[model samples]
Each structure stands twice: as C-alpha cells, then as structure tokens.
Target: MKKIEVFVEKANDGTYWGSTQNLPGGVSSYGNSFDELKQNLKAAFKDYLEVGRKLNENWVQEIEQLTEFEYQLDIASFFKLLPIKISAIAEKTGINPSLMRQYASGKANVSEKRAREIEKAIHELGEDLLSVSF
Candidate 1:
C-alpha cells in the first residue's frame, strides 16, 4: 500500500475541497463541509485504487510513485493555511481579482498559468515573511 497526503480547504462559498499535491488529476469532491468533503475524497481514492488494481498494468506503480513525489514535497499542509487574500494575490500576480476570487472560491477551474502564478506568489510571500522573522 502507498500513502498519499490529502489537503483540504474551505472555499469562500462555504464548501470544502481537497486534492493530493502530487497527483495531477487527484482532486476529489467539493462539499458543504469538511466531513462531507473528506468522505467524498475517501470514496474517490478507493475508486482510483480499485481501478488501478483492476487495470493490472503499471499504473498502480505510477500512482505509488506520484504519491511518493507528494510526500517529498511535504505539501499536505499547503491548503491548511490561508495566508494571503485573493485581492492581495491578484495584485501580486497581476491576475484579475475576479478570476483570483473565482479560483480561491472554487467557482472556476484554475488554469496552469494561474496556478503557477499563485504558487509563485505564495512562495514569495513565504520567503518574505521568513526573512522578516529571521
């Protein structure tokens, strides 16, 4: 068995969403509460594992490798903290505020570029705060 870390976040619309950091399409259900979201994610992971097992191909190993990647990054806590506001993130990343809000609220799909921008912004913020504290 492989271990994968799941991160959950509460969207602005009062729903919860979660994903595994290393799995490209490993995102799970969006629900009105954390427990509901977790339950849905459990079901999703079970189905994913079962499908991989049924396929009887190298896909199961691939998924295990992906989970390993996630473990290396220690991204399980990525969604645990909401450090930056959508407006601030938009201002920093030059992304539209509405789009940022939509992405943060889980109302819209995050484009690759947008996701990169968000990641960059978060990284910069983390570095800055660390520098200030140190």
Candidate 2:
C-alpha cells in the first residue's frame, strides 16, 4: 500500500483547505475552520482509501514517503486532549454545533476560521485550568 500525505493550510478567506502532497490535483473540502477541515480530510481520506482498496492499489507507502521528515500530528487526538467539550468550543466560537460534531466525527469539513476559534478556546481553557491548578 502506498501512502499519500495530506497537507492542509488556511486561506485568506478563513477556510481550511487541504491537498494531498502525494496526489497532485487531489484537493478536498474548504471548511469554515480547522476542525471542519480535519473532518473533511477524514472523509476524503476514507474515500480515497476505499477507492484504492476497490482498485487493489495501496497508496500508504506513497503517503509515508511524502510525509517523511515532516512533523506529523493527529488533529483528532489533539481535539480530544482539550479540556473543554465541543459544545463549549462551538459556543465560544459561535460555530454551529452540528458543524463541530461533524468535525469531531470526521464527517464534516471545518473552516480555517473555525479552527482558529477552536485553538483559541482550547488555549484559553488550558490557561484557565492551569491558573486554577496553581
């Protein structure tokens, strides 16, 4: 199986857009936040894997090569490590609950703006928690 590493970046419009560096012209959803982007990427990756499986082609190796020497981070796990709930994040960011849910479940696309909001909320919550602990 060849692996394909996907890279996501935020656009000026506050959308999280992603493309597989291993697969040229392979771009996925443009979400309103980072969480949405992660969700969209999950869906896109699943589809890509399924299609590859159906064709008896494995791109896992390719992806590994593409991502080699690059810092790899699991966005979902990072979200899970947050001290706050998705609901809180949504409330703080004014993002739709449904959208946050989708991102959590890997079923929806998150925009760059949303991602920033989530990050900000998580950071703030972490700081607050630290202050309490001290």
* Predicted candidate 2 versus true structure: per-residue lDDT over 18-72, tens digit per residue: 6666564463665776677667776776676567667767654454244222212
Whole-model lDDT values for every prediction: 0.64, 0.61
Which 10 residues in a row give candidate 1 its minimum summed lDDT?
A: 68-77
Residue-level error in angstroms, candidate 2, position 114:
1.7
Question: Top TM-score: which candidate number?
Answer: 1
> Model 1, stretches more than 4 Å misplaced?
1-83
Question: Which residue pairs clash within candidate 1?
Answer: none
Each model's backbone clash number: 0, 26
